[model samples]
Target chain A: MHDIGVRETIRFLGLTFNIETLKMTWLAMGIVILIACLATRNLKVVPQGWQNFVEMIILWLHDQIDAMMGRRGRMLAPFIVGLFMFLLASNLIGLVPLMASPTNDLNTTLGLALLVVVMVHCLGLYFKGGHYIAHFFQPTPVFVVINMIEEIAKPITLAFRLFGNILAGEILIIVLLKLMPIWMPIPSVCWLAFSIFISCVQAVIFTMLSMAYLANAVKEDHAE
Target chain B: MIVLIEINATILAQILNFLILVVLLRAVAYKPVARLLQQRSDKIKGDLDKAEADRKAAEQTLEQYKVQLADAHKKAQDIVDKANVTARQEHDAAVAETRKEIERMKATAQAEIENERNRAFDEMKSQIVSLSLAAAGKVVMKNIDTKENDKLVNDFISKLDKNMFADLR
Candidate 1:
């Protein structure tokens, strides 16, 4: 934990980075990729064993994306699915002792939030063009400032929401682990299960919200 | 005493970090994983398509079998109908043959009866002729001479008349 808190640690050839989060993130990413590759290696029309299960998950994600984004969801399926799997894996990796979730750090969450915001704006501009900017000035000119403030608040809210939830869960588990020695591991176990559930939920929620924002931005002519 | 300094991440630093992570993830993780998923989906779709094709072919084969069965049934019905017609024609021919045989027997029997009646009539005619001649001869012999012949003839005529009258009565 002390080693994790200490920032700007460099070891080889002056490549200074956050040690714990970066390492876990890489490891999680590698695991997801490896699993995907291994599952799809001998692709058959009638999937057997692990490939069949993995295909079900992908198809399920496809349905969720379609539900959230409608026809355009198919286009965004790969990106959102990839993001969900990556985040879920990273979050679950934190459950292991001595491993920190990169998402628990503000930097990672902020980065992801900003990426979503930028993509949202880009899609809005691409789809709606000049009309997209006009959405902020709706009802009255005064509302434009409010809309702008809300847009600015989005990334801050997104980052803190994820970071705070994960960090708090981790801290609570740590505390519980220390407070009760005999039955102490029970709470940790429960917390671990809960954290896994919460991580999956958060990933889905985050992707769903991002898709909604994009969908809202991309609506062409809302005259009424 | 070591003082803990809080280092704020600059926008440039954050952006650089973000780009690096994105690039790394894209290269090492996201692309490969997504590609694998795409391949799997393609495989599944291929399998589904094959199954659908097989189903359609099976349906077509079933239809063919049904059509063939129907044709076979129709042919069987036609054969049965032909057999019934042949049986009916043969029955009618046999009845006509029986009727012709009865008509020939009736005609033959009528001809035999007519011939028997003609022969009986002929025999009766001959007998009557013979009897008449004998009566004439007896009258002539009993008279013997010239005057008595006339008288005998008159008597004979009178007697014949009486007899005729009696027969008539």
Candidate 2:
């Protein structure tokens, strides 16, 4: 099996760099950006071809954001859509020959989770003010410790859930390939299809969780 | 065949890449497409409003035309009715005037015929007196006195009753 971590680092100017994940991440970013540019270029009032496809994807993402985040979804739609696109591209890249999925690395998923957690807290403070921190001690003071622990667990679980699933899928595919190397391609093919399904699901889950976090953070606190 | 788990600089690089992608995609794609959609919807709304206004104006004009046509029809009917009444009155007056003229002409003709018959009766009476006087003169012959005879005849005629002439006729 390939390394579970982003193991390939290139030393440059006395500094170490994790080159494999970085390169793959950059490749994913480039492909997404290129498609975005092509889709937006020469946009007609009447859309056709690539524009139609891109618009459909954007409209679906918008609907997801609206459903999950309610009235406040409009402000965050672009970021959420970008997150989904990036995750989807990164996850699917592993299906191609000689490419590793960047999301398989703990560092990458953790970084994304940290970003979400920080944004959530910041938005909570902005929208709810003191009530944001006061939610932990609701009903009685005894629940404060539990609430704090739950809050800390949020990022860890978010990161590990996505990382574990994608990494396991890739590992399973590798093992299946090795087990049936010649003449019998059914097992490997089936595993590949399953891996693809997992990748798509993980990307959707990450995006949905992120939106949910945002919605929870920014919502108005109604005292009961 | 081995796997390593570590935290390193790749996380920061990935974060940076993700942020850049978000900004780039937002600039090149999301904003423009959204603006185009809004503009198209606004244009469609304006066109619909204009079409509605045009339809309303056409309906108003048609209504005015209908009213005018109705008025013209009523006016024409009134004129025909007035002409018929005037013609009937004129015919009635002409007939009454012709009847009055015929009555007046008949009265004038009857008066003229009565005057002519009276004049003819007077002429016949004068002729009879002259002829009777001549016959009396011839019967008396050379011995007869004309003046005396004439006086006698005049006296006799004067004393005679007019009713005796009616018996003679």
Candidate 3:
């Protein structure tokens, strides 16, 4: 079998950019968004049946956001909640027999990490103004280099952390399934349970970290 | 050298695959899901607001009812007290009229008894005088001598004078 790693997936088109992963990511994003929209199109206040269940999930996410982010967290509630739901859907879709998790690839995680990094910087700068950049010097001038390196490393580490976890977990599950045919049912059930739990946890952690980073930036800006 | 090139190509491929996934997810999943969630949140806030307003109104209405109930009870009690007072006054007036009537009857009966008693005393005195005059005329007729009759009349007059004088004092 092919190594099936991220390196094998990249290809350049002229001087512009890569194309395949973008298309797949977009497709996956589109399907789930469409489904979510249709599900909540007609919202009744006292939700009945399916609508009630969907609304409950949304409310639950809001509560979690409130708990983690506080009152200011309410504003970011929709974004963070939407991110988790979408990620969970994407991850679970990968578990389908013929499909693969988009997150199992480094490129997908990198894009998500890039988005988070951009959001964090934008928020931090907005709150701190020009002084936000000055935080790099921190305790001493020599720390400036260390801080800069850490800043640069942040996206790489975050992206790889998620990618590695998802890829390794998926691989282990697959290998176990193949090895124990007699105990196939057990592994399948365990994999499903574990994967779903991990997927949700990862989504929460990612969103929480982004919020924390932004909050720190804003706090620093106000302090100065 | 060939292995290094292949490794680079593989990395590139994986990156492309991931990019496609993210783009697809953003367009198809995130947009619609976010919109739906926002709508649901707004709806919940609205319901909560409505419930609060309704509760406030209900409390106000309850207060109004309590006031009205108290007022009604006061009015009922006032009517009862007024009726009792009116009945007491009527009873007192009836008793006073009965007493006045009884007093008037007693006064009239007393006046009638006093007039009858005076008439009886006057009749007894007249009867006694007539009997005494008759007896004196008889005695005069029987005596046959004028001087004797005169002496006897003088003695009777003296005796009457002494008795009358004593009675007058």
By summed lDDT, which 10 consecutive residues of candidate 3 chain A come out lowest?
Answer: A1-10
What is model 2's DockQ versus the real complex?
A: 0.36
lDDT of 2: 0.81
Question: Which model scores highest in lDDT?
Answer: 2
lDDT of 2 at B27: 89
What local lDDT score does residue B56 receive in model 2, on the 0 to 100 scale? Answer: 100
- Per-residue C-alpha lDDT of model 1 across residues A77-122, encoded as one tens digit per residue: 5566666777778777777787777777776777778877898899
**Compared with the true structure, what per-residue lDDT tens digits does model 2 show for residues A1-224?**
24434376777776566777788888998888888888888898888889898888778887877776666767777788789889999999988867888898887898899888889999889877888888879878899999889889988999999889887888777777777858999988888898899889999999999988888886554552
Candidate 3 structure quality by residue, lDDT tens digits, B39-137 = 767988998999999999999999999999999999999999999999999999999999999999999999998887777656655755675577579
Candidate 2's docking class is acceptable
- Tens digit per residue, CA lDDT, model 1, B1-169: 1111222342224445445544554555445445766776788899999999999999999999999999999999999999999999999999999999999999999998888767766765575557556766876777667676667556656665566446433
Each candidate's DockQ score against the native complex? 0.07, 0.36, 0.08
Per-candidate RMSD, Å: 8.8, 6.9, 8.3
Question: What is the C-alpha lDDT profile of model 2 across B5-116, one tens digit per residue?
Answer: 6777777777777878889878888888778777778988999999999999999999999999999999999999999999999999999999999999999998988787
Ranking of models by TM-score: 2, 1, 3
Q: CA shift at B144, candidate 1, in angstroms?
A: 39
lDDT of 2 at A181: 58
The worst-scoring run of ten residues by lDDT in candidate 2 chain A lies at A1-10
Candidate 2: stretches off by over 4 Å: A1-6, A13-15, A222-224, B1-3, B47-62, B79-169
